[model samples]
Target: MLEIKNKLYNSKERKMQKLFNKYMGIKKFFRLKSEKIFPLNENEKILYTDKYDYKEKNEKNKSDKYLSFNKRIHILSVIPKNKIENFYYSFCNFVKKNPSKNEFSKIILDERLKKSILNYSNSLNLGGWSNLGYTTPKSKELENIVDYFHLFIFNLSEDYIGLDFTAILNKDFNHKLNEFMISEIKNEPNYCKYYVGNKRFISKTGLNKDIIRREKLDDILLEIKMRCYDFLNLYFDLFPLNNKAPITFDEYITNYEFNSKNDYLLRCYDFYIFEDKQISRDMDIIINHNDKEFSQTFLDLYLC
Candidate 1:
């Protein structure tokens, strides 16, 4: 009987010790180092590199001409105002005629209704805040008037994947769209060039920030550009512009390249080394030259 009691007490003590050790281990794992207590300036920041002198020289001579160091690359395609207007008209007509039980119907109808209300408000001079004394009236005919909404093709891994026809409704539409698209592309089965090192080794030890060789970096950038081209092609294929011949990849995307000595890229590399996972890259798009005018018109007509 005494032996059994001793065994039970020993087991309980072992369990308590295991729990306490686990808690401390976790706490230690998450604790910030003394050096990280304060923010470091660009020059003072510590990077895991053997060639510190070479890196410093490179940083001093770094050019600001290339695209940002963020893994995502922005590809811009411009559509003529007339083409966009035509597309909007066709889209509205299709939605009206088809009347399907999909979400597209609601989106299109709602936007149309809003546009009508905006036009009505403009005619009454109720929402005119612009310096222009008179507000221009929008045509009642959908085909004659241009819509303010921009179309966004969103692709998010494990989250959302679809089109956002009313992207302009949200003020942070650009950021949200880019974030979702990047997340979606990262989930692609072939998107693994960014994760090329021994993740386990890097995690057990510390990551060498200069692990990415110039040749490897070049390959990664090329792959990223190709991926961007493919993404743009897919979007255009699904929704052709003005019912015209499919635009060539070059026609759709003007530029896709990475800049040198980007801190964001370095941080992303560190994250992958430690987490054994890839973070979504960022991207920016060049809006059409007339986008500003169109945006102003949209604000004047709808938002006031």
Candidate 2:
């Protein structure tokens, strides 16, 4: 555990290093390999641990509870290292903001959140948003929604960079992300007036109900952004392709199969290069033995 911490600390991923340094207990949890089921304090019950004599216990009794639990823990252990890191940071950040047991339990049990985080972790393990060359329509749509929402928050409030657009959309507008777009834009004036609007959206007069609501919203947005960025920063660290070397020509040919060369694939292929001299030599040998004309055309199109 200490070795892993030291390695991560020296690596370029500072966010992950800081997370590990701040929450060393998590490292202990992951590293535990005991084979005994121990009791917790008298007041605590249902404390799950991976250390249980599953084989002996299952043979002694007909029950497979210990065996099942141990299997689940083993499965968790096999989760990609990056995903576990991301899950830890996300869990910690969520706990810091909402400490109540009920709140924490609700989030853990949320199926959508779990699935989304897992999918995101898988993407990070691969290459993240930029490396996703040609995605399905649904994925493309979600990315567009999130990206445009960020842009909308900036444009709506004259480049205000403090609000948590993701949280607001997740909590209040999960099913209707575009809800506020048309309504908010309706109040905007001609081009020049937009540059001189007040920082606060609502008025502060009379009972000042709108002002209080705006202030409260701002505070919630700020809190949400804090958690979101904390998760994002940690996830960015776990994203393996964040600062990876460009894909070599041989690697590109061996790994990926392009059915049709669309503009997006063309753009991505252009980014792939032969940095390693050996890989470049191997690619030339393969190209010579294969369809030379096709290879020449592909190189002409994408090779830098």
Best by TM-score: 1
**TM-score of each model, in listed order:** 0.21, 0.17
Model 2 Cα lDDT, one tens digit per residue, 1-304: 0012222123566565445444533433543433135435321211223233122111121232111000000000112433444554554454344333232222332565445444443342332221111111112212322221110001112211111212212223322322221112211111111223654221111112222332333233233223333333442332232332111121112223333334233332232233222233212221222354544212211011
Best of the candidates, lDDT: 1
Candidate 1 C-alpha RMSD relative to the actual structure? 21.1
The pairs that clash in candidate 2 are none
Off by over 4 Å in 1: 1-71, 86-109, 112-215, 235-304
Error of 2 at 43 (Å): 54
Residue 73 lDDT in model 1? 29
Question: What global local distance difference test value does model 2 have?
Answer: 0.27
Q: Candidate 1 residues 1-73, lDDT tens each?
A: 0011122233675567646545544543444243377544433232221223233221321344222232222
The 10-residue segment with the lowest total lDDT in model 1: 295-304
